[model samples]
Target: MSDPKTEEDIFAEVDAEIAAEEEAAAAEMDEPIGPSDSAVDGPGAGVDALVAERDELQDRLMRALAEAENIRKRGERDRREAEQYGGSKLARDMLPVFDNLRRALDAIDEPSRDVAGGVIEGVELTLRELLNVFGKHGIRPIAPEVGDVFDPQLHQAMFEAPVPNVPKGCIVQVMVEGFELHDRLLRPAQVGVSSTPAS
Candidate 1:
């Protein structure tokens, strides 16, 4: 059989339970609150980390944009060059034909021209048309004449000779005219340079 509980015993038991709960709460309060020590260095550390990450990303973005701009510029330059001088090889091949036509005209004497006047007229017309087409395509002649100063950029010396009254480094004779495609030289004019010294 169980004995009945006294009022004083019950009160004492309740006081002990209350004390245990208070002790537990006090222990919790004494310990650190929020994140643990290993989780973060200090206040504002997380913000600094985020700012560094943002700066790195921004730098990468700028570099990417700059590279893209350079690629675009290079492509544009290539396209312009293609447009301006794409048929340079064909133009160069056709030069011999022009030379032949000019030779034909030059070889025709007055009597031969009188005998084949129609054929001569046709050749002249053909030559004129060929020149017109060349002009339209930005292909032009670099015609160096005698007495002009020899320029390595536009003239190729076929021979060097000492001539009277001609200054040194001057073009004594022109063998073949040069041609250019746009701003680029397709060929330099073949010339004879004088090696005469100034007296």
Candidate 2:
């Protein structure tokens, strides 16, 4: 209180305070900031994590695409099958009508045919038209001839007979013709098979 401070002393004290602040700031910058090891590896770790995430997302995308493709193919196959086999039941139900028509034709004798020529001709024309329609619709008859080799896939054995000069497993008689729609068998031919061995 007795001595008054001069301007120089005041200026020197201000300079000393600023110097101390600068020294403190410099010391803080020189020291390691945050965790030293983590700071060194942070960028690489971040890049690695991003790459792994990208790979995982890519894998998921590929699996989803593959599943979608499989579903599409399966749907296409189902549609094609539906289109090809849609009328199988109707085609099968009409077979008995065709068989009855054939039986009617077979039952007529020569005398009846001569007496009712016009009526017989009408029936024959109707039968032929029916066969033409069947041909148009991919329906074909499997008519197995007598003495042909019997095939279980296409023929149903109605009876077995032992006839002379007939080979075993050969067809001796055809009872009824089979029918097919496209590549599918609508009915198997009924036949009599020979049980006699070849001479």
Judging by lDDT against the true structure, name the best candidate: 1
In the range 16-105, model 1's lDDT, one tens digit per residue, is 655565566556556676777426455445445555655675567568667978999999999998999999999999999888998899
Q: Count of backbone clashes for each model?
A: 0, 0
Single out the weakest 10-residue window by summed lDDT for candidate 2. 42-51
Alpha carbon lDDT at 185, candidate 2: 92
Candidate 2, residue 185: CA error in Å? 1.4
Q: lDDT of each prediction vs. the true structure? A: 0.83, 0.81
- Tens digit per residue, CA lDDT, model 2, 1-199: 5686654565565556555655665565566767875567553454455456556755675686679789999999999878777777988888888888888889999999989999889888988898898788888899999989999989999999888888899999998889888888989999999996645
Candidate 2 local Cα displacement, residue 108, angstroms: 1.0
Q: Model 2 — TM-score against the truth? A: 0.74
